[model samples]
Target: MAMDADLVTAGVLVIGDEILSGRTKDKNVGFIADYLTQLGIDLKEVRIVADDTDAIVEAVNAMRACWTYLFTTGGIGPTHDDITADSVATAFGVRIDHDPRAVDILTRHYQAGELNEARMRMARVPFGADLIENKVSSAPGFRLENVHVMAGVPSVMQAMMDAIAPTLRTNSALLSETIDTGVGEGLVAEPLRIAQERHPEVVMGSYPYLRDGLFATKLVLRSREQDKLKAACEDIETMLADLKGQRQAQI
Candidate 1:
């Protein structure tokens, strides 16, 4: 599908058997989402897959083609299960080998005896990929075209994101406003619907919560345009005030 030219979009792929098995709880997805949102890149989708090669390859190919950037976390470590580098190389039909730059980084970080074969696995990068510096650990992540492969460790992944953020393309930040309607969603559904119809440019959602043992709704409106969001918010407030007045008269 053709993406909107005005918006920068992204997809996240979380790869690891441990995450799927619930052994490791995910912390990177939320962090990445908030990070992208702040940079005006809409995170359109997120998928979690195991260490399996086919699944990784498929997800990498699909997400990279559809979004402006695809960020994958996990499976880049120095173990048998760390197959992300190979899978991504296969997906892009590129050769995989130990990158001299990555090897040098790992070499400098580790002592002479510590840079074993297993540790060297971290240096295997897809051809023509630029290394993403990991400030926490020297085992660098890589950027191949639009795909960014980073370590699953939260701190390292966050550091990698910081390293890449400055190089990314961004759009206008998404703006949002919320209103506490002080009534149940059922009571204000029609008015909210009318408001949405009147302002088709704004996206609206109703979140119902319990307040003082009674149901109350929080209506959220989001838009890229500031003026449109403000206008829609004002309209909703006016409509809600009229509804409140009618309810008071009935009581």
Candidate 2:
């Protein structure tokens, strides 16, 4: 039997001192959120921890136990600070080994002179982990159980996501419909709240923006079931139309 869409949840763990210390702005959070939403996976929580092994281990343990799926970005490079693989291994009580499949990809891309020890470190995977292909670079990321370890580099991480996304079970794509109201959120909050209560299955949100010295609000209705999203959108539209009619009638 199919279950409710809200029953599934996922989490993301970003591993980097650069992000924690404000040295680097993280771009993967929004990208992963959007990607997971497309797969009908609700991104429930996100944790950004420094490159410390204990921090990474703690986050991996907690998120893995809670969420249906856990994705981690960064700390997978060959540099000294890249310790995510080992940290994950320790967390899972497993061993880290050089994955042959990853090595094969690296070997094909590089000559003997170019294949150095540092680059080979990227091939290491936690015990019983599966390699995630890096289409942009020879170095590969990995997946263990429900946790997916991906690179911090956007291009490489995107390629890894493409390779692994098809293998996982996906629910229905989340559908969202939006309408721009030429009114502030405060003006429409009451009606929107009523609309939301009427369609509890639909996730409704209002984003206010300033455009051309005027305030406007974008009302969005999101849901995994397309029919529910459409129905909710119609209700919201009807309410907004009534509000407009009232204003015109007064004028």
Candidate 3:
């Protein structure tokens, strides 16, 4: 955690009907979250919409308006069903056309006359967007305002992130500490709540786990303020120890 870091936040839009129907498992959301977090940008929301135009447009506009940045994956490829480019254009109220730079990149990647009309569809971009290089496939993604459009494929999306990472804005990355207690959440809830009350600025949560028929509670504390986060973690540690000791005494 850094003292002067601003809370830059982002949202992710996963567009595809295949994903909703369970035909295509999503592989981009987690990567986007981890990537953004590494850049100190908090991922506040993630929306998965169908390939339908209205759905994509509405979700994109809504998330883009609210977050510092919005990332979209899927539906940007070259096919009849790939309506993401058009939907994004409609959302921004801008024209969509074959971007020459994108076309040139594709041209070089494909042999003469091999780059057909369908493949050229990858070159289409919304007006006013800057191309995001795709080192893996040459068909670049684009960045329009706060919205970044990337491919659905995991490797390609990862490459696009690398290409665009330098341009993204960031803030203080969250810091987290976890303490495990060999007891159930019910045994620690009250004391944990009291500790959280003492540190309002930190986020505190308890997760219960069952292993080998034994229950345990994992307390995770997160905060951008390192000092406060450290103090809260310390308090939780003491609370857990005292609680465990008391339980042992009663046995």
Off by over 4 Å in 2: 1-8, 245-251
Off by over 4 Å in 1: 1-3
Better of 1 and 2 by TM-score: 1
Cα error, candidate 3, residue 42 (Å): 0.7
Tens digit of per-residue lDDT, candidate 3, span 18-87: 9999999998999888988788888889999998999999999999988889999999898999999999
In the range 12-78, model 1's lDDT, one tens digit per residue, is 9999999999999999999999999999999999999999999999999999998999999999999
Best prediction by lDDT? 1
Candidate 1 residue pairs in clash (backbone atoms < 3 Å): none
Model 1 per-residue lDDT at 117:
98
**Per-residue error at 106 for model 3, in Å?**
1.2
**Two-way TM-score contest, 2 vs 3, winner:** 3
Candidate 1 vs candidate 3: which has greater TM-score?
A: 1
User: TM-scores of all models?
Assistant: 0.96, 0.88, 0.94
Worst 10 residues of 2 by lDDT: 1-10
Better of 1 and 2 by lDDT: 1
Cα lDDT of model 1 overall?
Answer: 0.95
